[model samples]
Target: MELEIYQVDAFAEEVFSGNPAAVIPLYEWLSDELMQHIAEENNLSETAFFVRKGEYFELRWFTPETEVDLCGHATLASAHVIYEFLDYTDQAVVFETKSGRLFVDRDNGRYSMDFPAWGVREIQVTERVSDALGVRPDLLFMGKRDMMAVFEDEQTVRDLKPDFAKVVQLDGVCMICTAPGLDYDFVSRTFVPEEGILEDPVTGSAHCTLVPYWAARLGKDSLIAYQASRRGGVLECANLGDRVKIAGQAVTYMKGTITL
Candidate 1:
């Protein structure tokens, strides 16, 4: 079997600066095992596979190890592929996903995605959390699928050198460390060693939690955010009580055929 694949750097103005996701558009669904193999071979943070379904698309995301419920950067990359390569003319694209209906709109060169707002509640800071991150957080919160650790400054979040072994032992799919940004409204870094991604470059889905938290903390509905990964990314964010809007640009990095 031969499948066309596109590698896109999401939330970046240029290549090599954001989270890279592989997008494969299929006419019909492939076997889960086969898709997982493909994602593992791609070796990217997330691989998005979608099938056109009338006016919308059915999308799924996979990491090297397993399928995930939601992925922001991959979704953005998928929309970019549909619009830029698949010759899609619609101003917006709708996706039916595990997380429910997702919408991505294209304005100029930027793609804005509407995602669910995930609220978090305060959690006790554990010794394991501090050992994993090498620093204790001032505030810790638990979200739907992730744990958030709040710091007082951006430098602390950026300077973290997590022990991936210890990080994987923590409860939740991933851990998010965030603090007030120096230039933007907030800054964050996401780690998921269990899922084969030690750190995510530009996490759009994490922003679902970050936007709401920062909006309430900063007392603003609109804000700018930066992910402090080695390959960083910037996001334009808006909190809408139940949903959040994350906007960023994507660039094509590679396009080729995958043979199986």
Candidate 2:
């Protein structure tokens, strides 16, 4: 079978400036192992697989190592591939995913994602958190698939050099260390060694926890965010009571087809 694959840099207006996700627009579902191999072959953080089902679509995410329940940047890439590549009719697309219903809106120059506000619960700081990060954090919190450590300032988040192995020990999807940003509302970085990913350039799901965490700290519903990964990404985030909207632009970096 021949499948169309597109590489889009989500949250970036220009190519090679944001998190790149591989998007595969399918008319039908493929085998699980094939999807995993395709994602591994892409060698990016995530490769999104989707099939149109009426106005909405069914979306799945895969990393090099395993299939994930949810991923933000890749989902955005799928939306891009459908609207910009396949010419799906609609400025917006709804994805019925394992994570639940996700909506993506095409804007004047960017895409806006409406994601659920993650329920973050505080937890005791394990020795691993201190060892991996090489510092003591003020507090620790764990969400459905992420671990967060509140730092003293943006510098702490920037200067962190975590032991990726220790970071993998955290019982969550990813490891996040965040603090108030001087130039933006908040600054953060994500690590997911367990998923065979060292650092995620841009994590849309991490912002779910980040939005609420910063909103409560800054006493504001809307704010700007920056991910300090090597590629780097910027986001305009807003908390809308029950949900959070993460807004950023995407660029088509590469387009091709994969034969399987």
Candidate 3:
């Protein structure tokens, strides 16, 4: 079988500056095993597959090792594909996903996605979490799928050198270290050793937890965020009750057909 694929740089204004996600739009669902194989072969942080379903699309995201319930960059990339490549004329796109209905709105050159706010609660900072990150957090918050380690400043987050081997042993989906940004509202770096990602260049879903926490802490409804990964990325964030809006730009990097 031959399938067309697109690689998009999400949360970036240029190629090679943001997280890259593989997006494949299909007319029908392929077998789960085949999709997993394709994602593994691509070897990007996340690969998104979607099929049109009436007014909305059915979407799923896969890491190299497993399927995740929600992914931000990949979802942005998928919307980019739909708008730019799939001849979709609508300015708004709705996706039926494992996390329920997700909406992306396009205006001018940016895409804003509405995602569920992940519940976060203060947690005791264990030695395992501190040792894995190689830095003690000022505060620790536990989300549904990940943990947030809040530091005092941006330098603390940027200076971190995590022990991925140790991180893998710590319970939870992944770890995110964040602090008040020098230029933006906040800055963050994500690591997903359990999902085979030593470091995620730009994690959109992590912002779900970050947005609500920072908004409440900063006493603002809207804010700007930066993911301080090696590649780096910028996002416009807003906290609205139970939902968070994440906005960013995507640039297409490559387009090709994969043969299986």
Ranking by TM-score: 1, 3, 2
Give a tens-digit lDDT track for model 2, residues 190-215: 99999999999999989988898889
* Shift in Å, residue 44, candidate 2: 0.6
Cα-based RMSD of the predictions, in order? 0.6, 1.1, 0.7
Which lDDT tens digits does candidate 3 get at residues 114-169? 99998798999999989999989999988988888999999999999999999999
Kindly give the number of clashing pairs for every candidate. Answer: 0, 1, 0
As for lDDT, the candidate ahead, 1 or 3, is: 1
Query: Candidates' lDDT values, in order?
Result: 0.96, 0.89, 0.95
Q: How are the candidates ranked when ordered by lDDT, highest leading?
A: 1, 3, 2
Q: List candidate 1 segments past 4 Å from native.
A: none
Candidate number that wins on lDDT, 2 or 3: 3
Poorest stretch of ten by lDDT in candidate 2: 82-91
Q: By the TM-score metric, which is better: model 1 or model 2?
A: 1
